[model samples]
Target: MPASSTDAYITDFAEFVQASPSSYHAAAEVARRLEAAGFARLDERDEWPAGGRHVVVRDGAVIAWAAPEGAGPATPYRIVGAHTDSPSFKLKPRATSSSEGLLQAGVEVYGGPLLNSWLDRELELAGRIVTDDGGEHLVRTGPMLRIPQLAIHLDREVNKGLTLDKQRHLQPIWGAGGDGEILGELAASAGVPAEHVVGHDVLVADTQAPARFGLDGALFASGRMDNLSSVYAGLMALLGAPNDAEHISVLAAFDHEELGSESRSGASGPFLDDVLVRIGAGLGAGDVERRRAFAASWVVSSDAGHAVHPNYPDRHDPANRPVLGGGPLLKLNANQRYASDAAGAGFWAAVCRQAGVPSQPFVSNNSIPCGTTIGPLTATRLGIRTVDVGVPLLSMHSARELAHVDDLAALGAAMAAFLTPEV
Candidate 1:
């Protein structure tokens, strides 16, 4: 790709990160972009058209597909899988509380977040609120909260090793010296009545905007890039690929991977399979034909991987040291934690080779364990060949993470190659 196009891709990725603070917001932003790309919105209760670019949103999950005119059930699906949610703090019920001269918001740690990274940063409460009338509204408080770390004076050993109590120390201060409901601001942002908000699923999000920095503007930093990088890459690849490929191309962005992917919207659930079955039915496929399609289908499970931290090089496999801007990583594990086997690795290598980009291998150190993605779960559920791949990042789950602009574009190119047929 040209430098101009790479610059535009980075700009668009920054815009995507800014627009998506929570999983719900990520799904909404994806649907918005899909519609802008001429993909029609789909409803689950309604019958689907046989052939078209269609997308559907179920809670925080989205599945979009392009079925050519003569596509059938036996036509294999080339699926690009990623998640929408990231590690963050979630608001607790009756979230208001008080500390020594400040009003705070009670929250629970949602996933494996680097607790120290969240300190002293401005944050926003973002998610969906359900009204008494059963209407759902998206809400966000731009910069309403802050989780302040205890000063060095208060904790003399802070610099040596900081320890935080999740319930007591992580509550964010939203106001000084009085009780205040954070929901009021969320309601105001969404233009909804605060009293009508009967239920909510709110998350604390870092308010920092994504940026490109460093000596030559090669480094990109942002929150939620762990999975959003893959999500956005898959979206771009799916939309830009030829519509008349031999396989039905689908982009499956699920929620709750950080929470072990057990929920209905996660990859462990039937969301992707349900959509594929419906599409097969529309193509006059019975159980056997659908099984045949499943036999031939492939899913590229794209997530974020470690890029061999500079300060902690020993934490990664010494033989496979992937650096920033070193193209995308093909994640592998002997325990099936990443679901990338020899066959999947070969396939990904060929795809990246065809796309004219370098591919790096990533494996964890012997003593240290690596976090898992939705790869094995998706493969187990759908019985499809799944490959684990992603862009290399320095901080895996910090409030703000680091990535490379070149690697982001390279991942997108590889995804497009994987989804398209015959080069």
Candidate 2:
């Protein structure tokens, strides 16, 4: 049975937002989905297996495979990679502060969040809370805080796109007259005392779920669209792929991509290398052979690409503006920023054609410097041919983002086709 386009898009978007409060949650939900789909989980501590299955790494990354039960050696992998982290407010090491008899939680913005959009929205805290038990991982999921906006009388010039000083007025206010210990409050909810909880990586996100808008039902507004959209699409593609062993298809969802790829679970680390080595070894290849195999493989670095704004159309290239519901767009930047090349683009186009999927081209304005993703990094590190592509989105890093709901279905279908093309 096939899921309808609307059902797939809406359900996927909701699940994406729910499972992805942080990188840890994103990876956990991915692993759960893989397990539910009859994919076997591999132990990172053990040697890689010889056939197709799923492997979880670092609890911040996941690699799912679809290969024939047994195949010849030297069959290179085809990978679709995306990151799970997005721009939001992260709790500082010491998360509590008191200012003028009000309680607030200290936060440092993650990635490139639209600072102004965060004002006056109901904020929530969700992420992992580590306890002294070493394995007791608790996740808090709800609207735990709110940041009230100032009255118009207080900030009369706010309508003119005013700037916000992050350190001063951005923190959320909670429990007007409660005890000053928000940590203790949260710990009580988690069934633990504040002193028993050692550390946490808390995130503040919009509590609103994604929904359909517009008269024709073409609009989709959600959170974490910068990359989580890609993450969800990649996961669905892998899950829907045929369980054959000709060419193993893997999805690499990494964390910390928004912060320059420097973290342990980022694309710049040893996570991907270790997984490829394990996969090659599963197919009876050694380290040197694995390196050679990886070099011969290919990757589609799946991330969101910018679309031309209707009001500010001049900000985009006239010939290459990706429109809403126009299918997936191939992002290209000349300064080696996007990791796409002649070979990679040709491969992706061929795959789309074979899968009967439509695709478009995307290039930034000549006068503006373009942003980048994990595409180039992965291409350079593994020596694999890589291409960057994504659904056209609006308000990329805002508390709430927008895209075409149908575009998500198209992107997922295309990715699924790429994962499992007819032999």
Candidate 3:
């Protein structure tokens, strides 16, 4: 057979992740794709258009949707939600430091990352910089830094459990210089005067490019797979769905989910809620109609789920182990860590079946605690029935993560089915 949809999906996903080094870039990239698809940009401060495709963006979040031509105010939405931010190191305001004649950038760990995986890797700086004149620029310095690991001879006990101090060992060497040198480089790259650089939100990322690996290239590895994979999957599904579908199809990519999602552009904030309300108002909806719309709507919170590790078999639940390439997984937790319930899960399973896609179930081992996603928060805040699902992945929060190429395509199909009203 010729190249399957999975092959094409993986190819596009690799490019998306490489282009999106930070949340700001990720949102901008999503906007770029939406605009290319004939979606008009809508400013939050301006009145929303009544129908057709439109998109609204906040700092690091984006929401795009296509309303049915004759849809009423009570028409529910088929929404797919994902996060843009991943675990990485955020540069400090005063980010200049030096030790033993080596220049380093002061950094703070953002969210929970596998610290050891970042050591000894070539790194690059990427994020948004705000100029004094209110101009915001996305800057990227490819392969400009590294965080070298200490020689094993110096720490003879390296074979044992390794511990890293966030402030001490996690700083990445940028070269021999202070803040001015770094600022000058960023200014030149961003094409702005150094004096006009009043603020910045810079972060470090692995410089390694994404690639297909393993026998037959079944496995794909790259950085920022924790959530970007889901983001891309959702985008593809939204763009591929039938335009004349009954329900309004929405794609919501939020920011700061890796950091507990408390920011204005995060799931726990008012971004999604505000947009929904505005959309309802633009459709001539009253409070009751808005509530009715939400009550009838559904949201699928897509993130990266953990795959059963070959070496750590005992860590996964015996009955609910999820494996890469098996299929997309429906995440569940009785404690509400995930919002999936019997009805929501059934709905998703039916969507998968209709799409001719396979799916698996995932539950944390009784002995281990589970991680939370935006599913529960979206359900609670919007009063919309929600389910949590994802493609199984390995080395989730590491600088480089792995997932099966087949599973990526399966997820895209499943999401597209969910967005299709006929399904």
Candidate 4:
């Protein structure tokens, strides 16, 4: 509750977002933090180890846990779930093209991003690059590219409405020349030879750093905040909780949630289930014991939610408008788009009360469709009680987003309390 604590958490969160321009970088950053906190890294090929702090990374997905001392197969896990990937423009295989003497990098839109937000911004490329030797290197090119929007003189009706052609208008101009030069630049940035760079998974990102601002400097804004904020809170809560707590505290940051979570590392995949099973088996849990543990387990699917738009208040449900700095918002959708049901909602309310953290509720207007998160997919996959929650923000999937500094810290407190044993 100290001001210093909140400031520290927000500062760290901003640094995390700055370092993580892509899902791979995000996972790597999480792994780095976990290791720095004394969590050992585990390999899937090796036999599972006994009780201790450990982290496992599968591409852009990461699962970290701190097992309680003397914990067994039937011990329930207090899991905090989130995603790492954000909507951006992914560089295509043949990324080089020339348009009217401008060298542009061909790109494909990944997920539903506010395309207009990306126009006329300083952009950089970051992600993992694979060399012919099978070695993977993480590369961040800084602000080396720009997507210049058409001038108002060229499109006079831009104020009324604008339609973007993803294939035609989304290419970002990097420099003069062609593909060979761009490939060489990427290779040099990655410290590899151009010929050796066989493949890559990279995305363009805003180069501006996150900042705290407002009349009183109470708000924070940054990129990848839709879920990185949750990932950071979950990590802090798991690390802050005592290792001997009653439940095994697990932090799962998966990837590809923006694109329906169908990838192997996504929520719909077997990543969480597989890891849980391995943990149970290592604890000598039988099938029945694993089921029992799951029955007692719960998941807090944390992602960013929409704050009532000040300019378009009618878009939100009148009765369930959430505001920034109001504490974490509990997202509910009656159509199962979100996993929070009556029981889950009651349980989370109890947890918030115990943590002494204020809570808010959010439900989208029936006239508009609701967006889905990992909440429902995780619940369906694991059959665990799940509640969807997040910090309320204005820009949900823009190149840059805003969130409350106080709510960010409050989320960590709530998760820590949930991991702690009920007295």
TM-score of each: 0.98, 0.94, 0.98, 0.98
Lowest summed lDDT across 10 adjacent residues in model 2 is found at 1-10
Off by over 4 Å in 2: 1-3
Candidate 2: residue pairs that collide: 67-244, 67-245, 68-244, 68-245
User: Tens digits of per-residue lDDT for model 2 on 75-192?
Assistant: 7778899998888888888888777777888899888899877877777777677788864464664776777667889989978867677887788886566566766765766787
> What local lDDT does model 3 show for residue 389?
95
lDDT of 3 by residue, 119-141 (tens): 98999888988998898999988
Which parts of model 1 are misplaced by more than 4 Å?
none
Cα lDDT, model 4, residue 256: 95
Model number with the top lDDT: 1
Task: Give the alpha-carbon lDDT of every model.
Answer: 0.91, 0.79, 0.89, 0.90
lDDT winner between candidates 1 and 4: 1
Query: Of the candidates numbered 2 and 3, which has the greater lDDT value?
Result: 3
Cα lDDT tens digits, model 1, 226-327, are 989999999999888686788999999999999999989999888998999998999989999998998998999999999988888778887989989899
The 10 consecutive residues of candidate 3 with the worst lDDT sum are 176-185
